[model samples]
Target: MDIVWFPLHITLFICSVTAAASEAALAKPNCSSHCGVLTEIPYPFGIGAGCYLDHWFQIICDRTASPPKAFLNVIGLEVLEISVEGTLKVTSPITFSNCSNKPLGLQAPNLEGSPFVFSQKNRFSSISCGGIALMTSLYGSTIGGCLSICDNTNTRVLQPNSCSGMKCCQTTIPLHLSAFNTSFGAVLNADSQMACKFAFLVDHDWFTSNSTNISAISEMDSVPIVLEWSLLDYTNFEIYGTNNWTDDKITNCSSHCFCSKGFQGNPYLLDGCQVPSSVLGQLFLLFGGWWSHKVVRKRKHIKRKKKFLKQNGGLLLEQQLSSGAVNVDKIRLFNSKELEKATDGFNADRILGKGGQGTVYKGMLTDGRIVAVKKSKIVDRGEVGQFINEIVILSQISQGNVVKLLGCCLETEVPLLVYEFILNGTLSEYIHHQNEELPLTWEMRLRIAIQVAGALSYLHSAASSPIFHRDIKSSNILLDEKYTAKVADFGTSRSMSIDRTHVTTKVQRTFGYLDPD
Candidate 1:
């Protein structure tokens, strides 16, 4: 009875071993895990039918080569390595030419339907004496290019692993690029066979790690190119569950799905999502602390801006602009950066003049427009309303005799006023400086009187809001390059409503030239 039982047990053991081997051959579900030497094909990528997630991840194992080779389906790009971060390493073909006038160009693979895309890790290179290489995106937009100009004397000392148009030239590609087209233009004076032009996209590591001569690029057929593989299509995980997925999940899925905060894993797979409990606590602490710090900084920035706005009379200006008192477009509110850049970081050399109201700096705008930036020495809390009144009055003045108020910068502790720069010295300098080489002529003096009178007349009567230049003086009158007088400095001016006869205000005027009326 014991011998009979032993024979039955042996048969059962053989059956179990065969079952385990069969199960190992079938990777997940019905997918083949290994294709010859390549055994690391994880989920989403499979060898045969029913094995892979879809046709996009299907791989073909070619056993006909000396050593078995595996290629991505349809595209025939040789597979080198697949990473957990969705990066695929594959062999890219090279295009080469030896003729001097005839330069060869290499085009990237047409990755139309596949889950794979060209990664930014790769750089497009052109090996030649001198030529213009153009890289274009799939949508027919020229992304970037590199030009190489070479000669016999400049041949031997090409920078090792550097592509800066010496012997070899290279440029970076955009991320998540599915397809690109590379073409080469003839190098101006490439006259040697060694100056053979070749172009290809290669992995950065291969270019740096290997001792590759630029002239010997034709000797190489295929270079390692990196690709990024994903789900290719995105399906709403909220609407489609793994157990009840529609055909769209298998076909038209999107590549936008990502692991939520505090969760990590292959977002392309179901149940592939995992939580590393050991590091999770630390990760949460780090991320949460960073988020909270950002929020605090943002709150501080808001509070500071609010304080400055109130101090700079931003509220009063807003109220005036909102009530249709001024044309909003005529008044430009400049930021601190523009003013800082225009004035060469507020260098002392740019100072045009200084006054009690503010200091004026000569600044060149980005558009080549010159302006005089008036920055107040101090922010008087009580005078905030008065500052806004000046801005409002200047925005309404359109007379050619008056200095045009171009814009203002309120982001600083004190508001800055921008005016069209007057090139010549002020009326006071031309009048008082007796030894000055360029004296104001009798006709010029008469023209200056007429221009100042016209500006004053417009301010007093023609303006939408009547203004009185209470502080008019020769010092306040600016002269342009042509010696045309431009009445300026409205800081101490007063405005009155249309129906009002006069504004009741303190008599603020420059001594010796006070308003006699």
Candidate 2:
């Protein structure tokens, strides 16, 4: 009898193990935010006091309102909805990017160099066939971009709509797009059909079925996006693979960098710290730029980009093709559906951050593609179009300082973009966070600032086609495992001929990081 139960016991054991993992995925960590009403804030995000990663991640939680209200601190975009799947339906910065009879309307501000980014895993899609969309995101290394198309045809009348270059299109972004810019326009092409343009980084599941929010647009006014914000772990300063000599089991965090006590300097450094220095009253410091460097090519397949541009009708594109100085194959495109599964239906459980435009979540695809997901407000009509533009542009440019585009999705009502994930969160979180001050030391901050400058110069002056970062703040600049900086988020970015200095616009950045002008 005992032997007979062996098989059953083994089966039960496997089942129990599976159940545990699932529970962890479903279990929402205690750290959370409480909105006034109708909002639920979960882990990696918090409310006042111990509720968040410091004030920057705090939720307003104004319960006095009838329906309740929550908001991000940086950009006062009102919060409408919050979910455990790491997504929220929020109002757009300029909810309607249409050129209707109204005055020049409000537009989602450009969010670059901020600690936030459009979750490359999230979709910037539209609701119906009568609208066009534009969007932006953080792709590989913080270079911003856009995706747009003069969509108006109802491609989903008889079947599910796909962004297969039809009435729809999509684009990817630099990995750490902390913020984005938004705009909506009528169909610019004669063959294309469109009435209104809608944009936002949406939950593919909700967007595909016209999500409840879209269905109830006539009733409610706005929705909120849960931005999954991140910051670089202090570990990057640990001095891995260094030339310094040492062979001792030691920890340098001093228990301050989220480690146990009996520690010393910043855990991010090699010998973190041990009683100042034996040099008595003097301390030593190194002056090299980077511990190591990897030089990547800065050119794309000029022919392919020209083909895509001509197919897409980018005037600046033809010129690039003529130059025959870049390679496009290096750019990648990803599927929207895959990103959906990766983000667990854009559940609130995976959220790592939130900010001016939307919320961001951490995602792990089936093939182990880890990513940060940015969700924009439902009102940004240009969300989808901007996504497509970003993919097209990133694929055509090659620069060491620039982030690379991976791929994008547009099969559902909303569109989803994909890109390599940057592990760190944003500069805001690191610099101002009350958690621990050990990470942003003299060396680390300088390294970060320098890396950012390199990327900015590349985008402004070096990119084959002159590009504008538009928003060059700290949040959009993401950090990697080695603490190296990677520029991010180009949702509001624009491309122009080398001869042009600035594009026509009045899109502003967040309060603190705005341009001096």
TM-scores of all predicted structures:
0.43, 0.35
User: Taking the tens digit of each residue's C-alpha lDDT, what string does model 1 give over 237-276?
Assistant: 4323444643322222355344455554444455443443
lDDT of 2 by residue, 1-517 (tens): 5457655755665564454332222223333335565434543345656444445445676568776777666666666654333344445542443335533444553445443445555455443233445443323232332334433443333225244444344455445445554444445564434344445454344434633434343233333334544344313223233545342424332322221244322222234323422321221121011111111111234444444333333443335445553344554434555777889988989887766555667788787878776655434443444544555556655665455556554433344456567776677778778446346888888888888777767776777776666677877877676767877667667777876765566764554553332
* Residue 135 miss distance in model 1 (angstroms): 80
| Stretches of candidate 2 exceeding 4 Å from the true structure | 1-328, 378-383, 434-437, 502-504, 511-517
> Lowest-lDDT window of 10 residues in candidate 1?
245-254
Residue 230 displacement in candidate 1 (angstroms):
62
